[model samples]
Target: MKLVEITLDYPYNGGETFCKQELEIAEKYFDEILLISMSGHIGEGNIRYVPPNAKLINARKARYEASVYLKSFFQLLRIRTIREIVFAKKKLRTKESMPQILKEIFIYYYYANLLKRVFEKEVIEDDDILYSYWMAAPAYYLSIKGKKALKVSRTHRFDCFIEECYQPFRREIIEGLDCIISISEAGKKSIEARLIPFTSCLSEKIKVSRLGIMKKSSATDFGGKSNKYFTILTCSNIHIVKRLDLMIKALEKINIPVNWIHIGDGELGEQIRTQAKVLDSNKYVKYTFKGVLTQQQIYDFYERNHIDLFVNCSDSEGVPVSVMEAISFGIPVIARDVGGNSEIVSSENGILLDKNITPKVLMEAIRSILLLDDDKYINLRKNAVRKYRECFMASENYSNFFEMLISMAKEK
Candidate 1:
């Protein structure tokens, strides 16, 4: 009857920009949609436009009161907590301290209990689809409480990477949800592997539903343009994992003229800026930092600019939408081969770098692209466009995703 979608700061801040396109598609299928924001930080920027049929619920402030923590302290005795403890002991490596594991377990149950309180107040029906954008507390809570509802959750980088982090009750969450939509095949495989240790037969429920962007009318042209400097572009939050500093260090060593443009800002913005200043002395390297831009603004930038390469040096990813966006414009990419990045970027379209890519390695990759013969470079651009049309086109991917959702809901 209705679809309830849970998200972290969607339609609020610049975060979760990918959700907007999916929501636009989802609104067409679901009669009534409830968009719930569970983020602690809200009202930072303009709230994104919501579909006419979708109702926005700002549950960002939803959390247990200090007194509620005392009252619900007995929740620690539950079987889920025991299972999480055992999972941590067996699966978690020495890098994760016992105290840290315990704290994560406590926080997991704390948020689960908090979501439980929030869900109790909502008027949900048996046939309504409960969709969580991430396999976090919302999905966990819905799986346990959403009786007869077609419960689904989309798993991405942080929530799905168990080997990288100690996520409490991953097995339990997988067991509870009816379907797990992974943004990449690698993510789906990771979830399946996590299920193996528990002898869980829920791998069939895990499916890969790649994220996409709307197709562009025209791809980037590689012909008949003379520019003073070879322009390079990178767009992502300037976080530690993003490794903007690595990109900067690489740019410093380049002998040829380059104009590096960075989009987006984060906690490491100032630090990255300081690191980028080192490039000023290198006449060969010029850089600019365009603070956070909306999705439209990014599209506009791609439309107006001549980007020779789009680079991502992130330590982890879920097939970054930025890459998809670049490929949509037929811009060749040079990204670290991590997560689902390899699935989209390859030798034909772009260069997939090693996960342990250093400044020198990145510089070499950039130089390789810049030095490609005009025919080879144009072919790469064409292949990039072909990849976008084949996999990352929003109309094709999201339509099939929502259609599947509608079919699943009808079965319920």
Candidate 2:
């Protein structure tokens, strides 16, 4: 079966990256797969560019986003002074740029329209399943075209936690889709609460299907080698919701010899550095902002580095791929036990935290895990890899997931 996977960008953004890896894994199930992403950089490979469009300004921002993701992936570079940089760049040369709000709206609409038109023209010629990576505006448009074998929309995120969310608006288009998959149970719940009002007022269905990661990367996955003392590493964008500051606070409170390293860059990185400085660079605490190391380099770091634990402090998540990767290299996680986290760990694999959790509470949890003896540590490591094989092993999970879609397509 030919499956046309739709996404907002190329295999760059987190969701699209998931789709990209899914396609790689699903190849055995689907005869041919075509990708339709507006942030499709047909030119520089990964540099996201809005394919040709009537909305030039929106296209420009797409280019800028593609460039930023490339920088994020390559050198761990941050887009400091976005406006200043845009004015200076060769593309957006004028200082008098459109208001940020208007530009974003335009880009979203432009991408949706461009995708709708492109798919309408292309799918007429190909008979296949339509598996959308995320329930963005583009997904809504693509599902309506002609003769689709199976139309599946996967929910990786819901902007619905806040007022004036767009999730319901997006779902209005796919309430009757063949099958809709949610990344996390939490995400599926949100879809129910938010979309009930508009369910096509239709009699259709959706399902919650999880995505997995490569069992092993061509790049070695990182597992902190230092088991002499517990070392926890958080690999995520250093954003506010990540709550890295609280991790620092927990470290300051815990008497155990501990060090934490944050692997990605974002808006909150400098604040993290300053907080570390305030702790007198605590004797037991060492911090490294390793920027964005390549996947292989990260794996090598895992093999050589002395890390004992992986921690996810994100306030929200869609089953972090990074957590799976850490475990793939035999590192156990002490995540905030939220979202699909439990799907990753339990008493058998690793530890979880409270939702209204405090620093002192977390400090105690880490302390309990770290205090485990050599035998316990070895058992946890063994269990971590077992879970990876039993559950994640992306190569097979991907094939199974797409095969489900492919079979549905055949039935349709």
Candidate 3:
């Protein structure tokens, strides 16, 4: 049977590198794999290599026009929409205004209908697996239209947590899917807590499937550094949630020499750069912005250079793969304790700061690491590598993921 995977933008954009290892494992299990991208298109640059058995479909070509919006507006009158509105009013103590809720519902139906039309043309079979990379519109559509196929979706921070994004018809989506896979135990718990108002049995379908990375050929040497400056690396889309500005502010307060290297770029890139200019006056704080790099390129950077610390000050996460990559190379992390960050990072491998981490608090965490004796520092590096092997090793995680998929397909 075939396996159809739905993604936002994989094999086209720099984002979703986490799917690369999982796809490699998936290629071995499914006879035919269809990679349908909801937002990916050709000539966007940095197109990734797809597996031999998989076919890439650029669904973005089917642009949503005024007609789609009109259709969505009409869908607001449907019984399902009304039921969801009633359910939300009774169960959820949402902070969103009525207009905001209605707007989100319109957008939801618009995308769900769009995705339904996109998949309608596909050659799906009864025993095939319809997997959504995110528990968003693709999963919502699949849950409605997946006929005898096994409908499954993986939830990340933004898609899984209501606080992160507006999830329309959350209950119905959970009810429709055969299984919902979360990237972290924290995410699984969150989903269960949200669904408690509906029914406890829905929680049975949820599972904690941690994302993993392939082990590097060699771990970074703790003492092998050409430069004397303490190197700090942060890799993520320069978004408001990532809090790059806070990092810059924190580095500004530190007295010791530091070389901060940021990987990846986003809408806030220019803004963050302007904010970082303040650090230029401080000779002790030197920062570099390495624009968007492919996953291999990031790993190559790790191999060639010695990174003293990796820091993630993000407001939320679903066990960031960037942190996993850093720890794989024995780089100790200093991340805010949010979402799955606590599961991967701790006092052993690195410092897990509180969620309400300010610039001053972050600076103190950095100083704490800088103050560690040679033996203590070396132990932290060793622990970082050990953590990567035990929890984030790709071979064990992805193999088990596909085996579960294979079992579900067979059972169906």
Candidate 4:
């Protein structure tokens, strides 16, 4: 059977990870695979960028520039490429800034033509299933209008709503599909909360699969003189949503001599550093701000470092990749019992903070996890590895997962 997976094809984002991991799994089962894309204006290769894979179609005359995003309201409204060229040329002749309208118009045509190519030219005419890796206008169009293949839409639910200005074409397109995959049960609830209000009935097309990471990640050494203090690895943005502050405050409250390394960069970077300096800059709560690294770097760090526990502070997630990576490495997790976090981590494998995910509670939980007897740590690690192998292998779970899609394709 023929199958194709399409994403905006941006590099190094969660959506990119989903696209790559799921595509790799699909490649093993399907005969034909097509991944189409145009250059997007995000961090080129930093945050989540990947070396080009599958099929790449960078349509820009040159690399994307900063001016592209500053389109005018009028241009944004009546966005058309023909009008954009005229607008840009007129602005240049007058030595004035191009209105935002021209830029918006350019992007509209950019995406439209890009999708036109993928739908009309690149995709195999008789593909059995056309999978949308991320929910967006392009995917919505293929799902709703493409007559050649069974359309499948997977909602990451990051912002799958019709906001004040941004139209949610993606949700509209997934209305009637062979499958509407949800990354987490929380994501499913978000769909029900946002979409169910308008409609009375929903379909079983909605299915949940926790995100996964490369199973065997290389470790990074925590480069310290001695491994005396318990090393905890906290991976997430240092933002209010991630609650890095809570982790820092909890460290202050705790009397134990522990050290934890932070594994991401975000708005809370400076604030968390200040908090750490104020609390105690000693080895007791050693906080390292390893800016966003490559996916392999992240794994290498985990492999080399003595990361005793994987702690998560985010308030929201589907099945977050950090937790999956931790489980895959047998590091276990200690996270707020919120969102799909509770679904991935269990009492047997890790400590689940009650609703009170405060500094005091977080401190106590860390102390407890670190203080676990030798047998307890071994058991937790053993059980977590077992869970990863049994329940979360990409090759196995996704085979059954895509098999369901194939079954649905037959019905359609």
Candidate 5:
């Protein structure tokens, strides 16, 4: 079968490190592959771990035409435009960003036209597949036109959470697609529930497909740790949603000294740095902002260093790949119970805090792990490794997902 995968920006730039591995795994399932990305960053590195025979296309090059805008405006008017306008007023909190919504609508219309042109030019067959990386705007837009190819979309947190998008996400787009996959059970539930407005039977169309990580060669040794120094590691784009401030504040409240390591960078990098200095003034917390590191660099850090625990205080998430990476290396996680985090963390493997977590709650969770006896700590480490092997290992889950896709394609 031929596979045509679409992403906002995966193999073309930084972020979505797991996507590189996903693309590589997908290569084995299809004889021919074409990767389509809406946009990409130019500078640093190639993010795709694709096979040598695959092709790449950037759909972002679709030029903006006034005709396309006019067409999209009329299209929006026919489908939930009034509701979207109301949603924008209530959710966005500003009229200034309404233009952004219009811009997205235009982009989506442009992409649909672009895909139609690609189908005409490249001659996509009925048996070929169009797999969208996210079940949001792109998938919705792409499904607006073409139906010859089997359409599948993987719905992550942002797409599953309707409030995250200002415009009312038309479920008809998803309903028309052949299959919809969710990264977590929580996400699956949300997606299924959202479809009730369209059809009662549509819930069965959404399936839970957990994201996986490559297992480490050897599990991290839990025995040897410096009594004086405890290291807490977190990997994510430094953003307000990540709530890095909560982590810093929690560290400040803790009596035990901590070395906090952040492995990613973003617009909030400088703000986080400034806050880190303020917390480090009394010497209770020492922050190391490692900027952005490649996927190999992250694995190397896990291999060479003794990271005591992994922490995630994000406001929201799907299934976090960074958490999977940490547990694969036998590091216990302390993540807020939001989104799909509870799927990975539990009483046996790691700690889960309430969604509305404060510094006191976070500090307590951290101290509970830190103050555990050696045997208990080692047990947690063992459980972490076991969890990764059973649930999050790449070989098992990805292969099963690929087989499912092949079966679905044949049925179609």
Candidate 6:
């Protein structure tokens, strides 16, 4: 069977390097694959890791044709756009960016037209699987493409949450797809909860499939090597949702000498840095922002540095891969309790703060973790490692997932 995998951005960007490992595992199941980049960089400076028997198509380069848009516009309207508009007016309207909403809708229309041309020009086997990384716009477009191939989509944070969508998933689109795999159990529940009111039949098609990461050979011990000062780390795009400012404020509350390191940069990079300086005015904390680094560099940093505890203050997440990566290094986390975080963090491995995580709450969590004795700290480290092996092992999870996908694609 063949697989056509669509991603927003994967190998070409440093952010979603895990998709490369996913593609690597997927290569074993399918003879030939089509790797389509919905919005990945294709310039000379960018590097892409593609599978052996796969073709790469950077759809970002494709220009919009008026005829394609017109055809797709009508098709989209038929797929519950009118109903969605009504729902949007009544209630359950999305708070996401207007430009982002427009972009998502346009991308689906663009891709639907693009895929039609590709299918017409090429040979697509009946047993092939059309899988979109996210179950938002792409899945809907793929569903209406009128292809015999199996259509599957995986739901993540933004795509799965109705509150995050300007226009939530259409009932027809969910009914149309062969299967929908949510990255977290929480995400699956959210999808089913929304779909059940409209049509209970679509609920059966949604399934929970957790994300995984490659395990590491060696991991850092709990409490780090030097107990004199705590070294806290966070790896995420510095955005408002991430609430990095909270992490900085928490550090300020901790009188203990500490080292704070941030691995990624984003919209709030400068603002975060400015706030970090203001919060750490007493010099009790040493701040180091590594901007953005490749996954290997991040892992290497973990290997070289003595990181005490990983912290994630995000308002929402879909079982963050960064937390998994931290777990791979035997680092316990202190994360805000929201959107699949409880699946990863617990009292045994780490602390989970309430949704309304004030600086006091964060400070207390950090302080309590820091106060752990050797025996307790070691146990926490062991639990982190055990959790990774039990849930987030890449080889086992992805291999099993692909097998299931192939079986579904082959189903008559």
Best by lDDT: 3
TM-score of each: 0.93, 0.78, 0.94, 0.77, 0.90, 0.92
TM-score computed on alpha carbons, candidate 2: 0.78
Q: Which stretches of candidate 5 lie over 4 Å from their true place?
A: 40-47, 62-101
Candidate 6 residue pairs that clash: none
Off by over 4 Å in 2: 12-15, 40-108, 123-126, 159-165, 197-204, 217-228
Looking at model 3, report the run of 10 residues with the lowest lDDT sum.
Answer: 219-228
Give the deviation of candidate 2 from the true structure as CA RMSD. 10.0
Tens-place lDDT per residue, model 3, 151-264, is 999999877777766677777678888899999998999988886458535567999888899855865666633256899999999999999988998998899888999999
1-412 in candidate 1: lDDT tens per residue?
8989988778876678888888888888888999888766565667887889998887635343675465456777778677677767776442588788767776666666666666778888887888999888777777777488889999998888777777676776788888899999999998787654674655788998888998545646555222689989999998999999889889888998999999999999999998888999998988899998878889889888889989999999988999999988888999998999999999998899889878999999999988888889989999998998899888779899988877887787
At residue 274, what lDDT does model 1 achieve?
89
| Per-residue lDDT of model 5, residues 1-412, tens digit only | 7888887776676656667667668888888888877653633365467677688776644445466556666776645555555544664343436677766655665566655655566757888888888876668765665557788888888777665554334455666687889989998887666554554445777888888987546656666344787988999999999999998888877787888889999999999889877676656677789998877789899998888899999999998989998888888899999999999999887798899978999999998887788888888888988888889888778888878888888898
What's every prediction's RMSD, in angstroms? Answer: 2.1, 10.0, 2.0, 8.0, 3.0, 2.5
Compared with the true structure, all predictions reach lDDT values of 0.83, 0.62, 0.85, 0.62, 0.77, 0.78
Give the lDDT of residue 342 in candidate 3: 94
The 10-residue segment of model 2 with minimum total lDDT is 51-60
- Superior candidate under TM-score, 2 versus 5: 5
Model 3 CA deviation exceeding 4 Å by range: 40-43, 224-227
Our tally of clashes for model 2 stands at 14
Model 1: lDDT to the true structure = 0.83
For model 4, how does the per-residue alpha-carbon lDDT over 1-412 read when each residue is reduced to its tens digit? Answer: 6676666655434436555566667776776655555456434544443233344444333445333334422335553334434533442222333454344344554454546645565546544787776665456556556475688767664534222123233334546455677776776776666555444347465677655654554332222222477778888766777887777777776666667788777776887888777557444666566777756787777676667888887765557777877777778679887666777788887987775566877878788878877777777887777767776667677777788778877776
Stretches of candidate 6 off by over 4 Å are: 60-80, 91-104, 200-202, 220-225
